[model samples]
Structures are given as structure tokens and as C-alpha cells.
Target: MTDQPTTASPAATSPAATPSPLAQLPGAVGAPTAEHYGDPVAEQRALAAGRALVDLSDRGVVTLTGPDRLRLLDSLTSQSLAGLAPGSSAETLLLDPNGRIEHAMHVVDDGETAWLIVEGAAAPAVAAWFDRMRFMMQVEVVDASAEWAVIGAMAPADAEPSIPAAAPNGHALVWRDPWAAVQSGGWQYAAEAAHPAADYPAVELIVERAFLAELAGLARAGGVRLAGSLAAQALRVAAWRPRFAAEVDEKSIPHETDWLRSAVHLAKGCYRGQETVAKVHNLGRPPRRLVMLHLDGSDAQLPPAGATVHAADADRAEVGRITSVARHHELGPIALAIVKRSLDVTVPLVVPVDGVDIAAAQEVIVPPEAGQSAAVPRIPRLGAKSR
Candidate 1:
């Protein structure tokens, strides 16, 4: 893997001059400042053990308020917003008329208002989409990225209390990822931001870029390891998380991305792309499916993203292409791929990465036939015979 320096402006200083927490990670092969994390496995373990906090401030937050909040969100996003309560969140997607995903978010309702947290670079575009579609709605959308800081914390089951309580003015949501239990929230420390808690433990802990450096050193001193982007990629694949650029594309539909089932609301009334979502849910089939690819061999290099995945015994006929790959010390090489839903899971596939032949075993994470339509193909079992 080559070192790719992060492209975004160093959260504060020059990327070339400032050493980042990402730089401190082991096996960091790239330019160190690139958008990707350096070591993912160590990061996963830190999250699983409840001792690590990852800076996700790069994520964008948009706030919607007023009486039209729920109504407006209901129309735009793919999830039902009617029943959301304080302290909870649901993953959602905003789709184009063709059902292609434009943005994905985690929506949280703080009882009186709603917050949409989306991928960092996508905030402005998503916000603009909402503004154009407002029409006659009585809603107000404001970009809250600057006023708040987003942080992700993973804690062990036994160390729940050790997890910091929600900041006085901040809202925290307990997130369940495949590797860990995460508690995430945003606090107001910028101007006009009133600290909600008078004596919160984490209030004094700065969440700035320099603080990230300190946290990195603290983690190392306390035996909390840092995982690079590669490890993080592998962990996401192992956990079956659908990444943005990998699993979703300009031609991808929300239903096809498997986000509709978890993020879309079939019961919500009219919205921009509602017609297409409803039509697909009631009558159409998703064109593609998301699956996990378990690579063969303990020492094999996971296939590169975009490598063609082919049936090993069928003259290397194409079945799918690898979207993400990682070398997990515990799980060996693993990948995430988008494939034709009708392909037989029993068929073994291979991805040629560099000069190495990486074996592929498909494991379905989302089934097309589960809810949307009968025409959708059923997910095949990769280990059905053994089970």
C-alpha cells in the first residue's frame, strides 16, 4: 500500500508541517495525511475495548428546526421521522429521482429539532438539495458543522460507566458497530455555545487537532494501539459496513445500496424521490447487492478496490468486483464487493491483486428478497452445507 497524504486542509496547520495522530500509527505506508486511516485493525480493537476516541469532526452536521422539521425531513430522507425520540438516531439516505443515492446520514431528533450528520465533503451539496426542495415547507436548515465537534467513542461492555456522560449541551447516541459499542455526540464550545452540563468530566478535554495529537500519545502510553486506514478498511469489510464511495455510486439506487430497508420510510408521505422509492419497494427490484468476500489464505494480500472478482473454475468469468479489502491479523484477508444478486454464493471467486491471486468467498449481508419485492433474488448461503 502506498502512502497518500490527506488532501483536506490540515484541520488547523499545514499538512506537511504538522505531525498527525495518523502519522503515529504503525505500518503507515502512505503520505499520512490522506483521507484514509493508516491502521484499521488496531483502531478496531481500541474501539472494541472502549478506550479509543476517533475524530469524526470531518463529518458534517446540519440542523433543522421549527414546526415543519419532522414533516420536511420525512419528505426528503428515506427513513420515517415521525417516531424519533431524543437520544436515538437512525441511518438514512437522500436519493435522486432515479433512486441513486446522493447522500447518506445519521438523523437524530433532540425532541424539539432534528440534526442530520453526513459525510464531511457532502454537507454543502445535501444542504443545497434540501433548500431547493423546501417549496412551501416551514422549515429552516442551517449548517452546524462549525458550531459543534463530532467525536466517536467505543467502550467495552464492562466499562460502560467509564464512558463519559453526554455533555451538558450535547446529545449522545449509542452506536452499535460490528467491532464495538460506540457512543457519539457533539458539544458546543464555540462562541454562543452554552455548556449544558455544569460539571461534565469531558468538558475540560479539548477536542481540537492538537488535542488529537495528545490523545494519540496518551493512547500509546496507556497501551491503546492506533490502527491505520488499511486496518480500518478491513474492519469495515469484516463488519459488513457499506462505505460511501465503494458501495454507493452515481448509478446506485437507495434500495440497491441496502440502505433503504434501514434508512428509508415506506410510510412517509410525499418527498422529492418518494415516488421512485415507493415504486421500487412496491414493484421493482434493486439492480445490485452488497456482499462480504472472505479471501483465502492467511498470508494473502486482499484484492485492491475495483479488481474484477471471477469464478475460479469457470474460465475466470466475472462475477463481481472488489470494493474494499484489508489484511486482518485475526480474520486474514477480507473484502466487500457489489455483485449481481443472482450469482450463486457457492461459486468460488478470485481477485487478482498485483501479481497475487486472492481467493474470494461470498457472504451475503443484505438480501434483495427480504422485504422490497418477490422478484428480487434470495441471498444464497455460502456455508449452508456445513450448517
Candidate 2:
């Protein structure tokens, strides 16, 4: 990667600078926002098949410049990014001292700049945190959320006419979702031999804010179709992918959502919250675990994000709460929920939609037995022979 300043196109600066041309598309209710065009089910199928693009323009974009960009990020975040190569992608987490997640970033480098695609609402704070951490370093942090937009496509990053334009160095500023397979120094808690993420090959492209209009114009001319957040979210839920916006809360830890598969580098050197991460993985289990809920679709109603989940026993004891819910085209209604690690995996669960309880069957993602991979040998009793 060449050492050059990252520049935005001469188009508009912000998503709100002008009404998006996409909002002008027919049946587009939440155009500049996140609403679907017309049919979400069809959109889901098309999006999964790489036939459509999802408008994720509201997501935040932060750029790190200077020679120390990768070094600074590697010294601070959960992933080891000091050697991140241009055009390569990585998912990482920022955690508190207690190991709770603070922010998650999808990072990609075009040599001179490391672009972070983050949740929109957390952009400012993330930038501020990076600024504060740059103590005497050569790295410069820029909250480019206002200057760029993000778009999601379920196609290969190099696919033509589907992905956004590439950078000057011929590198696409695309963060390919790494959840499909475990990364080096990462671990997978899911026991499934065939992971659902294998079917979900998603990529997010960072584009100039003004490019939204061009994309919208393309849609109008029948060049490409646009899908909304709903279709994108449904596919994510079906893939058992954990997103910070949906699955993370103030108390969330990487272990709880099986994020170790892509985000946490267990063997990496010191960083914030590294102690808790090592302790939990080597000797303890995360207090909570993630699960997929197959909800009864008899009523055709889906539960909200914070809907309470209960055990299917007579007392209907509460076990967990749904973090995200969606109606998949083939899977009916499904949800990602967090529950006590001790919750019996075999016991059926229930999710209340309105007033009635919808029966839910749990498909374990992060099992109760997750962690303790180190398997340290037990110490011998006093006066006992060492074996």
C-alpha cells in the first residue's frame, strides 16, 4: 500500500446532505433510512443469491491514517492487526477492562489508510476513543461517517458491477465478513460440522456519500436493485452471525456470542481486557451463551429484539431474552437469543409475541460447555503422589 492521503469523491458529504435517489424508488418508505423497497421476502432471496444490494449507508466509517495506523490498532483492539495487509479484512472488538465489549469494527486497509466500518451510532465515540489512545503516535483518526456511506452485498468482493468502486491503489475498501470460518489465533465454539455462515458470504463496501445517488440512479435504470435492512438482517440471523448493534449490550463479552471465531485472537499479546479473555477461555465459561430459536410460526408474528424468552416448563421460568428476531424465507421465524449458560439445551423455550407464548426450540450456538480449552491438569492433593 502506498502512503497517500485518503480522499473522498467530490460528491456530497453526508447521507442527509440531500435526499437519496433511492428514497425516490417506488414502494420505498424508509429510503434514506432503512426500510425495504417493496417485498422483503423476495429481497432476502435475491440478496442471499447475490442478486441485490442492501443499503447500509447509515453505518459509520472511520479512517486511520499515517505510518502507525496498523500498529496503533493492533496495540489496542482484540485482533492482531499490526500486520494487516492491504485489501485484507478483519473483525475486531474493543473491550472494557472487565472484558465487556465496547465497540466492534470491520477493518480493511488500502495500504496508507485503515478503514473501519462501524455501527453508525457508535462512530463518534469510537473515533474519540481512538484519538485518546493515539498518545504520541503517528496515527491520525478521522470519523469519516459524514463523508462516506456503507453498502452490503452478498457477492465476492471482486465481483463486477455489484461492488463499489476501488481505491486509487486498485484495492477495494471492502470488509469481507470473516464469520464464515475461524481465523488464525481464533477459536470456534459452535460444534456444527457444517456452519450456517458457510452459506452467508457478505461484504460491506465503503463508498463516497454522493455515490448513493449514482447507485439509486442505477436502480432506477434497472441496472441494479436495492434491498433494505430487513432482508439483510434476516439473512444474518439465519447465519447465526452476531452483530454488535443487535447482539451486543453493555455487559456483552466475546465469549457469550461465540465471537472468538473471528473477532478475538486468543493467543495474541496484551491489550485491553486480554486478562479476562484468557481467564475465561482457559478456566471458566462465559456466564451467558447464544442460541438460535426456532419459533412456532403458527401466528405468523415475530418477536421484537428485546422480547423475553422463557423455559417451556409449567412455571414458564424466564431463561433468556431475544436479541434479534426475523422471519426467514425458508426457516420461518428465527431469533438469536442470549440465555444463562446453565439453561438446559434440551428444554424447549417460549417467546411471547403480544400476549401469547410462541413455542421455541433452541439450537445451541455457544454451548454451556464452551471454554476451558486450556484444560489445565488438576493439582495433586497434599501428600499424594504426583501422577
Candidate 3:
């Protein structure tokens, strides 16, 4: 693997990158995937114990190769890839000129190739965009989603996974999640005692598609329980991680989801939409912010994705919508929502599900002052010299 580099064409400035259901994405066949391995409660425990294997077969994979790859990606995405050492992982956003998120790529650099884990629905378009952006560069971008697959393990990044894409640093090309803290050149928007994902160590490994099933079976034989997408998504929602496939809307910006903590390379040079990012980060907050909703589980009904949420009691005006929902084994009905930043964070919200009012209490994920405030008049500007 080597360092390298998606969805708008060189001419298509803001084409939609993903062809996903605007609403909820339910499971196929008999039961949801998580229940396939017995109880979701047990699976959740297995996940927390670092003894679970999840099949993320629907995720997309892309590979970038060539000497100029990292530098080229540095000029395009939000994260700084120019100095990404082999086996190190970083996440980046592809924004339109207006700074709306078009793509979010979890990048892992090996010595030979840079593997990009993206949403399956956006793979083709992202690959096409990458091809178009290669005007005279010495880079090669290929959609390897069909040939390769992604598997989530409840393990540390340094732990060896079977049949992984080798990195020069002796570890597999695992895109270790940085959402646990404010990485270098990143900012923490949500002030908490500790990030939930800190206790949950999830590592994604890229492997040949043909070997996926075999690997899972081997892990199970070795006493590692097998889980599916539902369990994986539940853990992610618990972590407050913004998934491009689930949380993004047509108007999403990095700041909206508190993704600026890990995705935006604040100190990087100019890239598309860099001005918008800088302006938003250094002088303003996003128009909307992501939040967590502790949904009422008395009726045992889960709000589907895209379900409208409103202020409770007096006036039921739509304030936000649920982006992802999950019924955790311990947390019960939980979900992530994107709402207008002006809405009172202390108010209880309501989501109507099949004629029943499912009560939702707001948990602030992205603070109102998530970005830089224009009121910081005392702070010096970039080039301002001090007396």
C-alpha cells in the first residue's frame, strides 16, 4: 500500500456523492443483521469486551497510489495527509466550494497505497470524481469496494488481524478512530468528562472480499463472537461519531457534526472550501449542530431515520430530525439528531412515530459555541503583530 487519493467531477462542482435512501435504511431478509447472532444485548456485551467481529461488507474501499498521492490529497481534503506516516490513520472531508460536506473518507496510509474507507452508496461517484481530478498527476485511484471488504473488530489498532493489508510499520492498515479526542490541529467542540468512544476501541481492517467470511468464521471458532452492522452502528452512535452515510444531509458541514475534532486540518493550506471552514471555525458557529436524543422507550418503538423532531408541549415546531437511530442493549432507544443551533438545548423534544409521541430529551453533542465566535475581538488575527 502507498499514500494517495473523490465525488464531483472536475467540472461538476457539487454533484451528489451518495445515492442512499433519504429515509431509514432497514435490514433485509428475516431479521435485522444484529439479531442474526442471537441477542443484540449479548452482541453489545461482546463488542464492549473486544470479542466481537462485525461484517461491514456494505462499506466502500478505494486505493490511491503514486509518489505524489499524499501531497495531492493534502491539497484536496480537510486533513493533512502530506506527512501521514505508514500505518497512521486520518479522516478527511471533501467539501463543495461552499463548504458543504460531499464526502468523508477514513484514510490509512501504507507505504505503497492509501486506502480510503467510504460509504458504499458513494463509491462509484467518488471514484469518478477522483479520476477527473487527476489532470496531470502521477496518481492512480481505483474503487476496490468489490474486490476488498471492511470488517470492524473490537480491538486495538496495533493488534494483528488475520490477512490484513500490510503496512511498513508492522501494523495493519487500520483506520484508528481519532474521535476519542482532539487530535493535532483539531478542536474539541463537545465538552465532556470523557468521550464515550474512549472506552470502546474499534479498528477497521481491509481485506480481500473472498476471505471475509472465512476470517469471521475463524474468529468465531477462536471464541470471538460475530456481530453485524446493527451492533457496529449502535456503538458508533454511542460514541457520537459522525458517519458520512448516516449523519450527512445535503447541507452538512464539518462543524455541524462536531467532526472538526478529527476531520479538519485547521492549519493546512488552501483547499476547496478552506475559506468557509476557516470562517466558520475562527469566527462563527454552524447554522445547525448535531445532538443526541435519549428517546422514550416505553412504547418500544424506534424512530426511523429522517423522522422530524419538534419542541415539546406548547408549540410543536420542527426543530431537528433524527439522522440515525438505534435500540441499544443498555441505552434502549437512542438516536442522533441534527437541529437548529438556536433551539434551546435544555428543552425536551418530541418525535412522532406511528401516531405516538416518542419523547426525546436533548443531549448536547455540538455546543452552541462549537466554532470560533465573532466576538473574540481581543484575540489577534493571523498576521497581526503584537506590540
Tell me the tens digit of each residue's lDDT in model 3 across 1-387.
211323323222111222112111233212212333556667677776777767665677888888878887898889988999987898899888889888999899887788899877677777767767867988899878767777777766556543455343455778777776788888778888787867667778877666655654565456445665677778888889889978998899999998888899788899888999999988887999999999999998998999999998798999989999987778888999999999988888999988999999888989887777446757689998889
lDDT of 1 by residue, 226-311 (tens): 44445445545665656675777667776554554356666666655778776766666666777778888755455568888888
Against the true structure, whose TM-score is highest?
Answer: 2
Candidate 2: TM-score?
Answer: 0.93
What lDDT does model 3 reach?
Answer: 0.76
Better of 1 and 3 by lDDT: 3
Score candidate 2 by lDDT.
0.85
Q: After superposition, how far is residue 243 of candidate 1 from its true place, in Å?
A: 2.4
Pairs of residues clashing in candidate 2: none
* TM-score of model number 1: 0.71
Model 2 regions lying over 4 Å from their true place = 1-20, 157-161, 383-387
Candidate numbers sorted by lDDT from highest down: 2, 3, 1
TM-score of each: 0.71, 0.93, 0.86
Alpha-carbon runs more than 4 Å astray in model 3: 1-35, 157-171, 216-223, 373-375, 378-387
Q: Per-residue error at 262 for model 3, in Å?
A: 0.7
Candidate 3: worst 10 consecutive residues by lDDT? 15-24
Clash counts per candidate, in order, are: 27, 0, 5
How do the residues 190-288 of candidate 2 rate in per-residue lDDT, one tens digit apiece?
999999998888988888877888887888889997887889988999999999988998789999999999999988889988999999998999999
The true-versus-predicted C-alpha distance at residue 24 of model 3, in Å, is 23
